[model samples]
Target: MKEYEQNQQKNKEHYEKVYANYNLNNILYWLNNLEGYLDFVTNYETSWSALYQNDFRNRIKGKKVLEMGCGDCNNAAIMAALGARVYANDIASTSGKIVEQLNGSFDFSHPIVFVEGDFLNNDLASGSFDFVIGKAFLHHLSLPVEREFLKETARLLKTDGEARFFEPAVNSKLLDELRWYIPIGNRPSKFRGEAFRKWKEEDPHPDRSFSSAHFKKAVNEFFEECLIKPVGTLDRFRNLIKNRKWNGRYAKWALKNEQKLPLFLNSKFARSQLIVGKLPLK
Candidate 1:
Protein backbone atom coordinates (compact mmCIF):
# COMPACT_ATOMS: atom_id res chain seq x y z
CA MET A 1 0.00 0.00 0.00
CA LYS A 2 0.95 3.64 -0.50
CA GLU A 3 2.01 5.76 2.50
CA TYR A 4 -1.36 7.47 2.94
CA GLU A 5 -3.18 4.14 2.75
CA GLN A 6 -0.77 2.66 5.31
CA ASN A 7 -1.31 5.61 7.61
CA GLN A 8 -5.07 5.21 7.31
CA GLN A 9 -4.88 1.56 8.27
CA LYS A 10 -2.54 2.31 11.14
CA ASN A 11 -4.92 4.99 12.45
CA LYS A 12 -7.86 2.63 12.17
CA GLU A 13 -6.06 -0.05 14.17
CA HIS A 14 -4.75 2.41 16.72
CA TYR A 15 -8.02 4.22 17.50
CA GLU A 16 -10.02 1.01 17.55
CA LYS A 17 -7.79 -0.16 20.38
CA VAL A 18 -7.96 3.21 22.09
CA TYR A 19 -11.77 3.28 22.01
CA ALA A 20 -12.38 -0.44 22.42
CA ASN A 21 -13.94 -0.23 25.88
CA TYR A 22 -14.84 3.47 25.85
CA ASN A 23 -17.56 4.52 28.27
CA LEU A 24 -20.07 7.26 27.52
CA ASN A 25 -20.93 8.23 31.10
CA ASN A 26 -18.54 11.19 31.18
CA ILE A 27 -19.72 12.33 27.77
CA LEU A 28 -23.33 11.91 28.90
CA TYR A 29 -22.69 13.97 32.03
CA TRP A 30 -21.10 16.72 29.95
CA LEU A 31 -24.00 16.62 27.51
CA ASN A 32 -26.35 16.97 30.47
CA ASN A 33 -24.43 19.95 31.88
CA LEU A 34 -23.54 21.27 28.42
CA GLU A 35 -23.42 24.96 29.30
CA GLY A 36 -20.78 24.44 32.00
CA TYR A 37 -18.95 21.99 29.75
CA LEU A 38 -18.98 24.48 26.89
CA ASP A 39 -17.58 27.11 29.17
CA PHE A 40 -14.80 24.77 30.30
CA VAL A 41 -13.90 23.80 26.75
CA THR A 42 -14.06 27.38 25.52
CA ASN A 43 -11.77 28.69 28.25
CA TYR A 44 -9.75 25.82 29.75
CA GLU A 45 -9.02 23.17 27.14
CA THR A 46 -6.34 24.21 24.62
CA SER A 47 -7.70 22.40 21.56
CA TRP A 48 -11.38 23.15 22.15
CA SER A 49 -10.66 26.72 23.23
CA ALA A 50 -8.81 27.45 19.99
CA LEU A 51 -11.35 25.64 17.78
CA TYR A 52 -14.33 27.29 19.48
CA GLN A 53 -12.84 30.77 19.57
CA ASN A 54 -14.71 33.72 17.98
CA ASP A 55 -18.11 32.56 19.32
CA PHE A 56 -18.12 29.34 17.29
CA ARG A 57 -20.05 27.56 20.03
CA ASN A 58 -22.90 30.06 19.51
CA ARG A 59 -22.69 30.10 15.69
CA ILE A 60 -22.68 26.31 15.20
CA LYS A 61 -26.20 25.93 16.55
CA GLY A 62 -28.70 25.12 13.78
CA LYS A 63 -25.89 24.82 11.23
CA LYS A 64 -24.68 21.90 9.13
CA VAL A 65 -21.28 20.96 10.60
CA LEU A 66 -19.02 18.11 9.61
CA GLU A 67 -16.26 16.89 11.95
CA MET A 68 -13.47 15.04 10.19
CA GLY A 69 -11.65 12.33 12.19
CA CYS A 70 -14.25 12.33 14.95
CA GLY A 71 -12.51 10.20 17.56
CA ASP A 72 -14.32 9.14 20.73
CA CYS A 73 -17.26 11.37 19.61
CA ASN A 74 -16.86 13.88 22.45
CA ASN A 75 -16.82 16.97 20.19
CA ALA A 76 -19.46 15.46 17.91
CA ALA A 77 -21.83 14.90 20.84
CA ILE A 78 -21.11 18.39 22.12
CA MET A 79 -21.82 19.96 18.71
CA ALA A 80 -25.07 18.01 18.35
CA ALA A 81 -26.08 19.12 21.84
CA LEU A 82 -25.45 22.68 20.70
CA GLY A 83 -28.11 22.15 17.98
CA ALA A 84 -25.86 21.45 14.99
CA ARG A 85 -26.80 18.98 12.30
CA VAL A 86 -23.53 17.16 12.82
CA TYR A 87 -21.92 14.69 10.42
CA ALA A 88 -18.90 12.96 12.00
CA ASN A 89 -16.41 10.99 9.91
CA ASP A 90 -13.76 8.56 11.09
CA ILE A 91 -12.00 5.47 9.76
CA ALA A 92 -12.71 3.55 12.95
CA SER A 93 -16.08 1.77 13.16
CA THR A 94 -15.83 1.94 16.95
CA SER A 95 -16.48 5.68 16.72
CA GLY A 96 -19.74 4.93 14.91
CA LYS A 97 -20.82 2.88 17.91
CA ILE A 98 -20.22 5.86 20.17
CA VAL A 99 -22.38 7.97 17.88
CA GLU A 100 -25.15 5.39 18.13
CA GLN A 101 -24.92 5.40 21.93
CA LEU A 102 -24.94 9.20 22.09
CA ASN A 103 -27.92 9.47 19.74
CA GLY A 104 -29.78 6.87 21.75
CA SER A 105 -29.19 8.68 25.05
CA PHE A 106 -29.21 12.38 24.17
CA ASP A 107 -32.09 14.49 22.91
CA PHE A 108 -30.09 16.56 20.45
CA SER A 109 -31.92 19.02 18.16
CA HIS A 110 -30.19 17.11 15.39
CA PRO A 111 -28.65 13.70 15.98
CA ILE A 112 -25.05 13.29 14.76
CA VAL A 113 -24.68 11.17 11.65
CA PHE A 114 -21.53 9.04 11.73
CA VAL A 115 -20.00 8.86 8.27
CA GLU A 116 -18.12 5.60 8.62
CA GLY A 117 -14.97 4.45 6.72
CA ASP A 118 -12.90 6.53 4.31
CA PHE A 119 -14.00 10.19 4.44
CA LEU A 120 -13.32 10.69 0.74
CA ASN A 121 -15.83 7.95 -0.08
CA ASN A 122 -18.67 9.38 2.02
CA ASP A 123 -21.76 10.05 -0.09
CA LEU A 124 -22.25 13.49 1.48
CA ALA A 125 -23.51 16.06 -1.01
CA SER A 126 -21.45 19.02 -2.15
CA GLY A 127 -21.96 22.43 -0.51
CA SER A 128 -23.89 20.68 2.26
CA PHE A 129 -22.02 21.95 5.30
CA ASP A 130 -21.93 25.44 6.78
CA PHE A 131 -18.75 24.50 8.63
CA VAL A 132 -16.09 21.79 8.59
CA ILE A 133 -13.91 21.15 11.61
CA GLY A 134 -11.26 18.76 12.89
CA LYS A 135 -10.08 18.96 16.48
CA ALA A 136 -6.41 17.93 16.83
CA PHE A 137 -6.95 15.75 13.76
CA LEU A 138 -4.90 16.88 10.75
CA HIS A 139 -1.41 16.24 12.10
CA HIS A 140 -2.12 12.49 12.24
CA LEU A 141 -2.11 12.26 8.44
CA SER A 142 0.74 12.14 5.92
CA LEU A 143 1.17 15.37 3.94
CA PRO A 144 -0.34 13.87 0.79
CA VAL A 145 -3.34 12.61 2.75
CA GLU A 146 -3.68 15.94 4.51
CA ARG A 147 -3.87 17.72 1.13
CA GLU A 148 -6.46 15.23 -0.11
CA PHE A 149 -8.54 15.90 3.01
CA LEU A 150 -8.23 19.67 2.40
CA LYS A 151 -9.40 19.26 -1.17
CA GLU A 152 -12.36 17.25 0.09
CA THR A 153 -13.06 19.96 2.67
CA ALA A 154 -13.13 22.52 -0.14
CA ARG A 155 -15.51 20.35 -2.13
CA LEU A 156 -17.78 19.60 0.83
CA LEU A 157 -18.52 23.11 2.14
CA LYS A 158 -20.73 25.97 0.99
CA THR A 159 -19.00 28.89 -0.74
CA ASP A 160 -19.12 30.94 2.46
CA GLY A 161 -18.26 28.04 4.73
CA GLU A 162 -15.12 27.75 6.82
CA ALA A 163 -12.91 24.84 7.80
CA ARG A 164 -11.33 25.04 11.24
CA PHE A 165 -8.75 22.65 12.60
CA PHE A 166 -6.97 22.58 15.98
CA GLU A 167 -3.56 21.04 15.39
CA PRO A 168 -0.12 20.77 16.98
CA ALA A 169 2.42 23.26 15.63
CA VAL A 170 6.19 22.75 15.27
CA ASN A 171 7.33 26.07 13.85
CA SER A 172 10.59 26.18 15.78
CA LYS A 173 13.07 23.42 15.05
CA LEU A 174 15.06 24.28 18.17
CA LEU A 175 12.04 23.97 20.47
CA ASP A 176 10.90 20.82 18.67
CA GLU A 177 14.34 19.27 19.02
CA LEU A 178 14.39 20.15 22.70
CA ARG A 179 10.91 18.63 23.11
CA TRP A 180 12.16 15.21 21.96
CA TYR A 181 14.70 14.98 24.81
CA ILE A 182 11.98 15.50 27.45
CA PRO A 183 9.78 12.45 27.80
CA ILE A 184 6.06 12.74 28.59
CA GLY A 185 3.80 9.99 29.91
CA ASN A 186 4.59 6.60 28.38
CA ARG A 187 6.73 7.88 25.52
CA PRO A 188 10.43 7.82 26.34
CA SER A 189 12.93 10.54 25.39
CA LYS A 190 14.19 10.40 21.80
CA PHE A 191 17.70 9.75 23.12
CA ARG A 192 16.51 6.51 24.73
CA GLY A 193 17.53 4.53 21.67
CA GLU A 194 15.56 1.27 21.36
CA ALA A 195 12.83 2.26 23.83
CA PHE A 196 11.95 5.44 21.94
CA ARG A 197 12.15 3.57 18.64
CA LYS A 198 9.65 1.00 19.92
CA TRP A 199 7.30 3.72 21.14
CA LYS A 200 7.55 5.52 17.80
CA GLU A 201 6.76 2.30 15.93
CA GLU A 202 3.40 2.11 17.70
CA ASP A 203 2.71 5.83 17.40
CA PRO A 204 -0.20 6.37 15.00
CA HIS A 205 0.89 9.74 13.66
CA PRO A 206 2.55 9.70 10.23
CA ASP A 207 5.95 11.45 10.08
CA ARG A 208 5.02 14.79 8.47
CA SER A 209 5.12 18.56 8.82
CA PHE A 210 3.07 20.22 11.55
CA SER A 211 4.44 23.72 11.00
CA SER A 212 2.08 26.74 10.83
CA ALA A 213 3.61 27.88 7.54
CA HIS A 214 3.06 24.49 5.92
CA PHE A 215 -0.55 24.31 7.13
CA LYS A 216 -1.23 27.88 5.91
CA LYS A 217 0.18 27.17 2.44
CA ALA A 218 -1.70 23.84 2.16
CA VAL A 219 -5.05 25.37 3.10
CA ASN A 220 -4.51 28.47 0.94
CA GLU A 221 -4.33 26.28 -2.16
CA PHE A 222 -8.00 25.32 -1.71
CA PHE A 223 -9.40 28.30 0.20
CA GLU A 224 -9.23 32.00 -0.61
CA GLU A 225 -8.70 32.95 3.04
CA CYS A 226 -6.44 31.17 5.51
CA LEU A 227 -6.07 32.39 9.08
CA ILE A 228 -3.63 30.61 11.39
CA LYS A 229 -4.00 31.53 15.06
CA PRO A 230 -1.22 30.62 17.49
CA VAL A 231 -2.29 28.73 20.62
CA GLY A 232 -0.75 26.97 23.68
CA THR A 233 2.68 28.65 23.47
CA LEU A 234 2.77 29.11 27.23
CA ASP A 235 0.05 26.60 27.90
CA ARG A 236 2.46 23.86 26.82
CA PHE A 237 4.45 24.53 29.96
CA ARG A 238 1.51 23.53 32.17
CA ASN A 239 2.83 20.00 31.80
CA LEU A 240 5.55 20.83 34.35
CA ILE A 241 2.99 21.55 37.08
CA LYS A 242 2.28 18.48 39.23
CA ASN A 243 -1.06 19.66 40.57
CA ARG A 244 -3.97 19.02 38.21
CA LYS A 245 -6.05 21.97 39.40
CA TRP A 246 -3.08 24.30 39.26
CA ASN A 247 -2.26 23.02 35.77
CA GLY A 248 -5.77 23.79 34.58
CA ARG A 249 -5.61 27.26 36.15
CA TYR A 250 -2.26 27.94 34.49
CA ALA A 251 -3.51 26.72 31.11
CA LYS A 252 -6.47 29.11 31.17
CA TRP A 253 -4.19 32.01 32.01
CA ALA A 254 -1.48 31.03 29.53
CA LEU A 255 -3.81 30.55 26.55
CA LYS A 256 -5.39 33.96 27.12
CA ASN A 257 -2.09 35.87 27.47
CA GLU A 258 0.00 34.02 24.86
CA GLN A 259 -1.66 35.92 22.02
CA LYS A 260 -0.27 39.19 23.38
CA LEU A 261 3.21 38.18 22.27
CA PRO A 262 4.38 39.53 18.92
CA LEU A 263 2.92 37.65 16.01
CA PHE A 264 6.29 36.45 14.74
CA LEU A 265 7.29 35.11 18.14
CA ASN A 266 3.90 33.49 18.70
CA SER A 267 4.18 31.83 15.27
CA LYS A 268 7.56 30.40 16.22
CA PHE A 269 6.85 29.38 19.81
CA ALA A 270 3.22 28.26 19.90
CA ARG A 271 2.82 24.56 20.66
CA SER A 272 -0.50 24.42 18.83
CA GLN A 273 -2.55 26.45 16.36
CA LEU A 274 -6.05 26.97 15.07
CA ILE A 275 -6.32 26.87 11.29
CA VAL A 276 -9.25 28.71 9.70
CA GLY A 277 -9.79 28.41 5.97
CA LYS A 278 -12.66 30.11 4.19
CA LEU A 279 -13.99 30.83 0.70
CA PRO A 280 -13.23 27.54 -1.02
CA LEU A 281 -11.54 28.02 -4.38
CA LYS A 282 -14.06 26.10 -6.44
Candidate 2:
Protein backbone atom coordinates (compact mmCIF):
# COMPACT_ATOMS: atom_id res chain seq x y z
CA MET A 1 0.00 0.00 0.00
CA LYS A 2 1.06 3.60 -0.58
CA GLU A 3 2.45 5.44 2.47
CA TYR A 4 -0.24 8.13 2.46
CA GLU A 5 -2.99 5.54 2.31
CA GLN A 6 -1.26 3.63 5.07
CA ASN A 7 -1.04 6.70 7.28
CA GLN A 8 -4.71 7.40 6.62
CA GLN A 9 -5.60 3.85 7.54
CA LYS A 10 -3.64 4.10 10.77
CA ASN A 11 -5.30 7.40 11.57
CA LYS A 12 -8.68 5.81 10.90
CA GLU A 13 -7.90 2.88 13.13
CA HIS A 14 -6.69 5.25 15.83
CA TYR A 15 -9.88 7.31 15.65
CA GLU A 16 -11.89 4.12 15.86
CA LYS A 17 -10.10 3.31 19.07
CA VAL A 18 -10.77 6.81 20.32
CA TYR A 19 -14.50 6.57 19.49
CA ALA A 20 -14.74 3.13 20.99
CA ASN A 21 -13.17 4.37 24.20
CA TYR A 22 -15.49 7.39 24.16
CA ASN A 23 -15.01 7.72 27.90
CA LEU A 24 -12.83 10.65 26.95
CA ASN A 25 -16.03 12.09 25.35
CA ASN A 26 -16.58 14.76 22.69
CA ILE A 27 -15.98 17.83 24.89
CA LEU A 28 -12.50 16.60 25.74
CA TYR A 29 -12.02 15.64 22.13
CA TRP A 30 -13.05 19.14 21.14
CA LEU A 31 -10.70 20.69 23.66
CA ASN A 32 -7.83 18.35 22.81
CA ASN A 33 -8.38 19.11 19.16
CA LEU A 34 -7.63 22.71 20.07
CA GLU A 35 -3.98 21.76 20.78
CA GLY A 36 -2.42 25.20 21.33
CA TYR A 37 -5.89 26.71 21.79
CA LEU A 38 -6.77 28.12 25.16
CA ASP A 39 -10.43 28.29 26.13
CA PHE A 40 -12.35 31.56 26.40
CA VAL A 41 -16.08 31.48 27.29
CA THR A 42 -15.19 27.80 27.46
CA ASN A 43 -12.22 25.89 28.93
CA TYR A 44 -8.99 27.72 29.69
CA GLU A 45 -9.81 31.35 29.12
CA THR A 46 -6.51 32.35 30.69
CA SER A 47 -4.49 30.27 28.25
CA TRP A 48 -6.34 31.70 25.26
CA SER A 49 -6.23 35.18 26.75
CA ALA A 50 -2.46 35.21 27.35
CA LEU A 51 -1.70 34.15 23.78
CA TYR A 52 -3.47 37.24 22.48
CA GLN A 53 -1.72 39.59 24.89
CA ASN A 54 1.69 38.33 23.88
CA ASP A 55 2.88 38.48 20.24
CA PHE A 56 -0.01 36.88 18.29
CA ARG A 57 -2.06 39.99 17.46
CA ASN A 58 1.06 42.00 16.69
CA ARG A 59 2.07 39.49 14.01
CA ILE A 60 -0.62 38.62 11.45
CA LYS A 61 -2.93 41.60 11.70
CA GLY A 62 -4.92 43.41 8.98
CA LYS A 63 -4.21 40.83 6.29
CA LYS A 64 -6.53 38.56 4.36
CA VAL A 65 -5.84 35.40 6.41
CA LEU A 66 -6.62 31.89 5.35
CA GLU A 67 -6.20 29.29 8.12
CA MET A 68 -5.88 26.03 6.28
CA GLY A 69 -6.62 22.82 8.25
CA CYS A 70 -8.24 24.86 10.99
CA GLY A 71 -10.20 22.25 12.94
CA ASP A 72 -11.60 24.43 15.77
CA CYS A 73 -11.20 28.07 14.60
CA ASN A 74 -9.16 29.17 17.61
CA ASN A 75 -6.27 30.50 15.54
CA ALA A 76 -8.69 31.94 13.01
CA ALA A 77 -10.55 33.67 15.83
CA ILE A 78 -7.30 35.19 17.03
CA MET A 79 -6.54 36.53 13.58
CA ALA A 80 -10.13 37.71 13.09
CA ALA A 81 -10.05 39.66 16.36
CA LEU A 82 -6.94 41.38 15.05
CA GLY A 83 -9.07 42.76 12.16
CA ALA A 84 -8.23 40.31 9.38
CA ARG A 85 -10.70 38.77 7.00
CA VAL A 86 -10.20 35.18 8.16
CA TYR A 87 -11.11 32.04 6.21
CA ALA A 88 -10.68 28.46 7.45
CA ASN A 89 -11.16 24.98 6.03
CA ASP A 90 -11.00 21.45 7.42
CA ILE A 91 -12.32 17.99 6.60
CA ALA A 92 -14.25 17.52 9.84
CA SER A 93 -17.93 18.20 10.63
CA THR A 94 -17.14 19.74 14.04
CA SER A 95 -15.51 22.67 12.24
CA GLY A 96 -18.97 24.24 11.84
CA LYS A 97 -19.39 24.36 15.62
CA ILE A 98 -16.05 26.15 15.96
CA VAL A 99 -17.01 28.89 13.49
CA GLU A 100 -20.31 29.29 15.31
CA GLN A 101 -18.53 29.80 18.61
CA LEU A 102 -16.14 32.28 17.00
CA ASN A 103 -19.02 34.26 15.50
CA GLY A 104 -20.68 34.41 18.91
CA SER A 105 -17.51 35.56 20.71
CA PHE A 106 -16.13 38.42 18.62
CA ASP A 107 -17.76 41.83 18.10
CA PHE A 108 -16.02 43.00 14.92
CA SER A 109 -15.97 39.77 12.98
CA HIS A 110 -14.32 40.14 9.60
CA PRO A 111 -15.34 37.86 6.71
CA ILE A 112 -14.91 34.28 7.94
CA VAL A 113 -15.89 31.07 6.16
CA PHE A 114 -15.24 27.41 6.97
CA VAL A 115 -15.36 24.96 4.09
CA GLU A 116 -14.94 21.19 4.26
CA GLY A 117 -12.51 19.62 1.80
CA ASP A 118 -9.11 18.03 1.25
CA PHE A 119 -6.50 20.80 1.07
CA LEU A 120 -4.31 18.74 -1.27
CA ASN A 121 -6.97 18.49 -3.97
CA ASN A 122 -9.24 21.40 -3.16
CA ASP A 123 -9.46 24.03 -5.92
CA LEU A 124 -9.25 27.29 -3.99
CA ALA A 125 -8.79 30.46 -6.05
CA SER A 126 -5.11 31.09 -6.66
CA GLY A 127 -3.67 34.02 -4.72
CA SER A 128 -6.81 34.23 -2.57
CA PHE A 129 -5.13 35.08 0.73
CA ASP A 130 -2.49 37.55 1.75
CA PHE A 131 -1.57 35.11 4.52
CA VAL A 132 -2.07 31.33 4.83
CA ILE A 133 -1.77 29.75 8.24
CA GLY A 134 -1.72 26.14 9.34
CA LYS A 135 -1.02 24.75 12.77
CA ALA A 136 0.61 21.31 12.80
CA PHE A 137 -0.59 20.37 9.32
CA LEU A 138 2.20 19.88 6.78
CA HIS A 139 4.25 17.02 8.21
CA HIS A 140 1.22 14.77 7.82
CA LEU A 141 2.29 14.22 4.22
CA SER A 142 5.10 12.03 2.93
CA LEU A 143 8.02 13.57 0.96
CA PRO A 144 6.53 13.98 -2.52
CA VAL A 145 3.32 15.32 -1.08
CA GLU A 146 5.34 17.69 1.06
CA ARG A 147 6.88 19.08 -2.11
CA GLU A 148 3.44 19.40 -3.67
CA PHE A 149 2.14 21.08 -0.52
CA LEU A 150 4.72 23.85 -0.95
CA LYS A 151 3.94 24.16 -4.65
CA GLU A 152 0.26 24.38 -3.81
CA THR A 153 0.89 27.01 -1.14
CA ALA A 154 2.98 28.96 -3.62
CA ARG A 155 0.27 28.69 -6.25
CA LEU A 156 -2.36 29.99 -3.82
CA LEU A 157 -0.25 32.93 -2.67
CA LYS A 158 0.13 36.18 -4.54
CA THR A 159 3.73 37.19 -5.21
CA ASP A 160 4.17 38.85 -1.83
CA GLY A 161 1.83 36.76 0.34
CA GLU A 162 3.02 34.73 3.36
CA ALA A 163 2.36 31.38 4.97
CA ARG A 164 2.33 31.16 8.77
CA PHE A 165 3.01 27.57 9.74
CA PHE A 166 3.38 25.67 13.05
CA GLU A 167 4.85 22.17 13.04
CA PRO A 168 6.38 19.63 15.43
CA ALA A 169 10.19 19.54 15.28
CA VAL A 170 11.86 16.39 16.47
CA ASN A 171 14.95 15.74 18.58
CA SER A 172 16.17 13.35 15.84
CA LYS A 173 18.50 11.20 17.91
CA LEU A 174 16.00 10.40 20.67
CA LEU A 175 13.20 9.47 18.24
CA ASP A 176 15.55 7.75 15.78
CA GLU A 177 16.65 5.19 18.37
CA LEU A 178 13.02 4.44 19.29
CA ARG A 179 12.19 3.70 15.65
CA TRP A 180 14.24 0.48 15.59
CA TYR A 181 11.88 -1.65 17.70
CA ILE A 182 8.87 0.55 17.14
CA PRO A 183 7.17 0.35 13.76
CA ILE A 184 8.22 3.85 12.68
CA GLY A 185 5.64 6.04 11.00
CA ASN A 186 6.18 9.32 9.17
CA ARG A 187 4.89 11.56 11.99
CA PRO A 188 3.49 11.64 15.56
CA SER A 189 2.13 15.19 15.85
CA LYS A 190 -1.24 16.56 17.03
CA PHE A 191 -2.43 15.52 20.47
CA ARG A 192 0.70 13.40 20.87
CA GLY A 193 -1.01 11.40 23.57
CA GLU A 194 -3.56 10.34 21.00
CA ALA A 195 -0.88 9.90 18.33
CA PHE A 196 1.08 7.59 20.58
CA ARG A 197 -2.04 5.74 21.60
CA LYS A 198 -3.19 5.50 17.97
CA TRP A 199 -0.19 4.88 15.72
CA LYS A 200 2.11 3.48 18.38
CA GLU A 201 2.01 -0.03 17.04
CA GLU A 202 2.57 0.88 13.39
CA ASP A 203 5.78 2.96 13.65
CA PRO A 204 8.76 1.99 11.48
CA HIS A 205 10.93 4.94 10.43
CA PRO A 206 14.03 5.32 12.65
CA ASP A 207 16.21 8.19 11.47
CA ARG A 208 13.31 10.43 10.53
CA SER A 209 12.61 13.41 12.82
CA PHE A 210 10.04 15.07 10.49
CA SER A 211 11.14 18.55 11.51
CA SER A 212 10.47 21.94 9.84
CA ALA A 213 13.48 21.42 7.52
CA HIS A 214 11.08 20.20 4.86
CA PHE A 215 8.87 23.23 5.48
CA LYS A 216 11.83 25.63 5.34
CA LYS A 217 13.29 24.15 2.19
CA ALA A 218 9.87 23.76 0.58
CA VAL A 219 8.83 27.34 1.34
CA ASN A 220 12.26 28.86 0.66
CA GLU A 221 12.13 27.34 -2.79
CA PHE A 222 9.10 29.54 -3.59
CA PHE A 223 9.07 32.32 -1.02
CA GLU A 224 11.95 34.74 -0.45
CA GLU A 225 12.56 34.31 3.28
CA CYS A 226 11.30 31.51 5.51
CA LEU A 227 11.58 32.00 9.25
CA ILE A 228 10.99 29.02 11.56
CA LYS A 229 10.21 30.09 15.11
CA PRO A 230 9.67 27.78 18.08
CA VAL A 231 7.07 27.79 20.89
CA GLY A 232 5.80 25.68 23.85
CA THR A 233 8.16 25.19 26.82
CA LEU A 234 5.47 26.90 28.86
CA ASP A 235 2.91 24.38 27.61
CA ARG A 236 5.30 21.63 28.59
CA PHE A 237 6.78 22.43 32.03
CA ARG A 238 3.79 24.50 33.22
CA ASN A 239 1.41 21.60 32.67
CA LEU A 240 3.22 19.98 35.59
CA ILE A 241 2.50 22.89 37.92
CA LYS A 242 -1.18 23.46 37.08
CA ASN A 243 -3.78 21.46 35.24
CA ARG A 244 -6.08 23.75 33.26
CA LYS A 245 -9.19 21.80 34.30
CA TRP A 246 -8.43 22.36 37.97
CA ASN A 247 -5.68 24.85 38.74
CA GLY A 248 -4.90 26.76 35.56
CA ARG A 249 -1.23 27.60 35.18
CA TYR A 250 -0.42 31.18 34.36
CA ALA A 251 3.15 30.06 33.70
CA LYS A 252 2.46 28.06 30.52
CA TRP A 253 2.88 31.05 28.25
CA ALA A 254 5.68 32.41 30.42
CA LEU A 255 7.94 29.45 29.74
CA LYS A 256 8.11 30.23 26.03
CA ASN A 257 9.69 33.65 26.33
CA GLU A 258 13.25 32.77 25.27
CA GLN A 259 14.33 36.27 26.16
CA LYS A 260 13.99 35.18 29.82
CA LEU A 261 15.22 31.56 29.96
CA PRO A 262 17.63 29.50 27.84
CA LEU A 263 15.25 26.53 27.74
CA PHE A 264 13.38 27.95 24.78
CA LEU A 265 16.49 29.28 23.02
CA ASN A 266 16.55 26.80 20.13
CA SER A 267 13.87 26.06 17.55
CA LYS A 268 14.51 22.31 17.29
CA PHE A 269 13.34 20.12 20.24
CA ALA A 270 10.96 22.86 21.28
CA ARG A 271 7.36 21.74 21.76
CA SER A 272 6.28 23.24 18.42
CA GLN A 273 7.82 25.14 15.50
CA LEU A 274 6.38 28.15 13.71
CA ILE A 275 7.44 29.19 10.21
CA VAL A 276 6.55 32.60 8.79
CA GLY A 277 7.45 32.83 5.12
CA LYS A 278 6.59 35.23 2.31
CA LEU A 279 7.06 35.74 -1.40
CA PRO A 280 9.50 38.52 -2.25
CA LEU A 281 7.91 41.92 -2.75
CA LYS A 282 8.37 43.11 -6.30
Could you report the Cα RMSD, in angstroms, for every candidate shown?
Answer: 1.1, 7.2
Candidate 2 Cα outliers beyond 4 Å, as residue runs: 5-62, 100-108, 175-208, 233-235, 239-257, 261-265, 280-282
Question: 137, model 1: CA deviation in Å?
Answer: 1.2
Candidate 1 stretches with Cα past 4 Å from truth are none
Per-residue lDDT over 127-196 for candidate 2, one digit per residue giving the tens place of the 0 to 100 score: 8778777776666666676667677787787787877676666545564344333332345544466666
Q: Alpha-carbon error at 225 in model 1, in Å?
A: 0.5
lDDT of 1 by residue, 1-282 (tens): 387788889899989998888999999999999999988877888888899899998899899999999999999999999999999999999999999999999899888999999987889899989999999988888888789899999999999999999999999999999888888999899989899999999999888899988999999999999999999889888878989989889988998898788988888899999999999998
- Give the number of the best model, judged by lDDT: 1
TM-score of each candidate? 0.97, 0.65
